[model samples]
Target: MRFSPVTQLSTRFDSVASDIAERLPDTTAGGPALAAGLGIGHVLVAGWNLTREINEFGAEMGPLMAFGLIGGAGLTVCVLAVRLFYSEFDSKQRWLVGWSAVGGATLFGAIVYISILVRLAEGRVIAEPIFVLSLASGMGAVAGVVVGELYATALQSAAVADRQRDQLEFMQSLFRHDVMNSLTVIQSRAEFLTQDTDGQNNRFAETILEYAQNIVGLADRVERMSDVITGRGEIETSPTELRPIVERQVTPLRKSHEEITFDVDVDEVTVVADSLLEEVVGNLVKNAVEHGYDGSDDFTVSVWTTSTGGRTQLHIADTGTGISEELRGEIFERGTSESGSGFGLFFVETMVDHYGGSVRVEANEPSGSVFVVELVTA
Candidate 1:
């Protein structure tokens, strides 16, 4: 899924705020303390400015006073809402609440700055904008934080619901498309084998075995994919040694396909990933070995890694019949290509992204194709 630029900016803002909140001296008191400060700030900024409007400039009010009132009300709501739901708010919600101050400050700061500039143009020598901007912004920040936390709560709930729905749909699809179909094939093949007069039919047995293996492989792949996809919690990652993992996964493939030449030059590099990284390496190697060999005995699969710009790029090149030009675009999507369940490519895409990395297929220098996976260097 893609996000708009505005959405992306807001997300970044929330993330930065969350980080700061987490790093506070008292991690427990960080968010609430900051929230309380914002409430006090709103009162000070609005109260001081409003006092001047009434006592110094007479009973008539101004935009600054109105802005102060709005900011105070927003701050009140924010504080109330946060206090009410403080116990239930997770890290995601807390960060969003932190962003409220940011939003409020930004909006009100601009308004006050613009308003003061207009007064100066009209030959009114009033208070300095900086002093007022600071206070007015405080009022806005409190209000902004109020809205942020509330919105965060709603958004987080929606995200959880969406994830659960996707999981349900994913399970439904597996049962309907993989298990049901494989079971039907297995049942039919078993009947044929049983009905064989001499009991010497290998085709039925082979077909059943093939389908069973597929189901098993699908189950393993689904588990690996689940580890990458964000379910109810965040995926944890550690610095995984890439060279050892790559070497291990490819060892079996090399032994099974002795006819095919294997060239490996992986670096002894580490990356921010987990044990599932092994599954990624395994699937990629299996994909190349299985799909790259067609008819000839001159098949070769090359694996290499390069580290540059804090990224470790793993390249898997195959010298055989390459993927069709038409299929390359949608290969990463779920159940996309006609060549099996399309789970392998989808798994690679999902896992790599979870590792804050990317995977793409490119045309090799001569024949066949190359899969380039770029992961963050540990």
Candidate 2:
């Protein structure tokens, strides 16, 4: 399934944003600061109205004015505290804590300020300051709980996205792997049937076998191609000795290309990699035999390894026509190969990146292209 450019860009942007957000402080802090500020402002306005009323009609406006001043001062302190505390929160947990404290303090302060004004306006100035403070604190604590819940929800959402991506990759791998194995069996069976010597049956078997081989080949290509799409087929690192893997991957290619020569350099070079070493080596050798000498009768492709500074390098050098500088980068990109499907070196690049390895296409000192892979090992 291919996504449209717009969809791909959107998904890419979203992925980047989510990754950044995951590393950022919790957004819950924003909520508390906003809620607290609004709550406090409202409370202050209400208290101001009450204070004005007491000044206009009350016998003792002095105490009410004093109370209003204190309430206003408390609200100011809450605002400053929220700004200071929110700034200190550099991570999600700290943000949540900061917001909770700020929101609670602001809400409590605002409510108490409002309560004081309300009491003064309604001739309830005798009401104790502690009583008003308790009510405001309770409300602020409740609001803090809501902020905490929001943070939990955001964390849950991130977890869900991670799970979904894992499930999607798992499904793609299952289908692609099973299909390749099935095709391999079918191709093998068809080849076995082709060995019989009756003309009619042989011809029919041969044709069927040819198409079957094509289909099998197509399936193999599709499986390889799908790896990049599903992001499953990159270098997977493990303790690996190069000789056996190189030998096994290249053994099957030897029978058909008798005109092409094989040169094995190292006996037992060890390295760490996923299965990329096999794919990279196999493709280079195959490419050398098929296209290196422009379908010429005589050519040589070498499979060799070397070790330097805790890292082992695998070299696949061909005696084919050397690659032009213009095509070096493009050749490793998908749908850009001179051969079938142009995905060979694209897969190589993906594999190299997966193993934390590096690849460079340099002119073979004097002749063909040299494909080199460097891998770290213990």
Candidate 3:
């Protein structure tokens, strides 16, 4: 396939940068400070020459214009440094900052470029400025790459450390809570299945499959998390169909939960989300099933979808343990409760927010709670 000129340039730029990086020490072996010292040496020599030129021509011309243009050229790199080095650093970043240095170098190049049009435009020796600028470019590239690569390495190291810490905590949390629960459920269901053999015995089998499904889902999550951390997979989003998401998650639950009736009045609408949308729906439905009814009383859950303005709202109303006004917001936060680990709701809330959606819990008419999830309609 053919590529655009812009694409061609970018590819060329990356290839060149990668090749240069291969030659340089990937570690902080040669300090950028040494290169900076070389740069400083040239600056001092140029300053001395420019000083002599200004003094000799002191009677004829002013150094005001020269100082302004030259000073502006020198200051350009200082300004661009913040933007170029504040994030993750890798060898590729060295090239980016080096390019910025080249941009600053052009201001000096402009002096030479414009001088050809009018030699000694300010009665200064053209050769001296050209020589000085050439030295500056050569030394400046070495300094910029050295400094940027070192700084980028530092930033990248710190970021990697933090990410590793988070990944550790995440895995600990998964095993401590989610994975453990699945195991407990599986053990209990297996024992229960062997002992109970009645018309309702299939319910235990279905619940086992459901728990197995959850265990598989948890594994997928861990794998995806690893991919994101290692820069292998990205969170790509699209207009996900809500109807299928609701059906896929709820269908197995219906088989597992025969006692509780699921009144689904959903629309075939689409929302701005990713593959995680189904997980969000599944977690919420499971939350309702687990905590919806009192042991003695019967309860029902009603799910429906409605759109208004540009937002689509999914309502999961359950006549179960209704959230208190005080606990409404806190329920979604990552924590633990008597009935459940709060990670499921926390994951749901996090994913919904990532998709530019909002989820909130409110009191149902007389009893229980209503979870209203507002999503960007697509």
Instruction: List residue ranges in candidate 2 displaced over 4 A.
Output: 1-229, 232-236, 295-297
Q: Clashes per prediction?
A: 4, 2, 1
- When sorted by lDDT, best at the front, the candidate numbers are 1, 3, 2
Report lDDT (Cα) of residue 261, candidate 1. Answer: 89
lDDT of each: 0.74, 0.65, 0.67
Query: Candidate 3 — what's its lDDT?
Result: 0.67
Model 1 TM: 0.46
- Candidate 3 displacement at residue 190 in angstroms: 4.9
For candidate 3, the C-alpha RMSD (Å) to the true structure equals 9.0
The superposed Cα distance between candidate 3 and the true structure at residue 107, in angstroms, equals 7.9
Q: Arrange candidates by TM-score, highest first: which order? A: 3, 1, 2
| lDDT per residue as tens, model 1, 311-354 | 99999999888988888898899888657788778878888998
Which candidate number maximizes lDDT? 1
Q: Which one wins by TM-score: 1 or 2?
A: 1
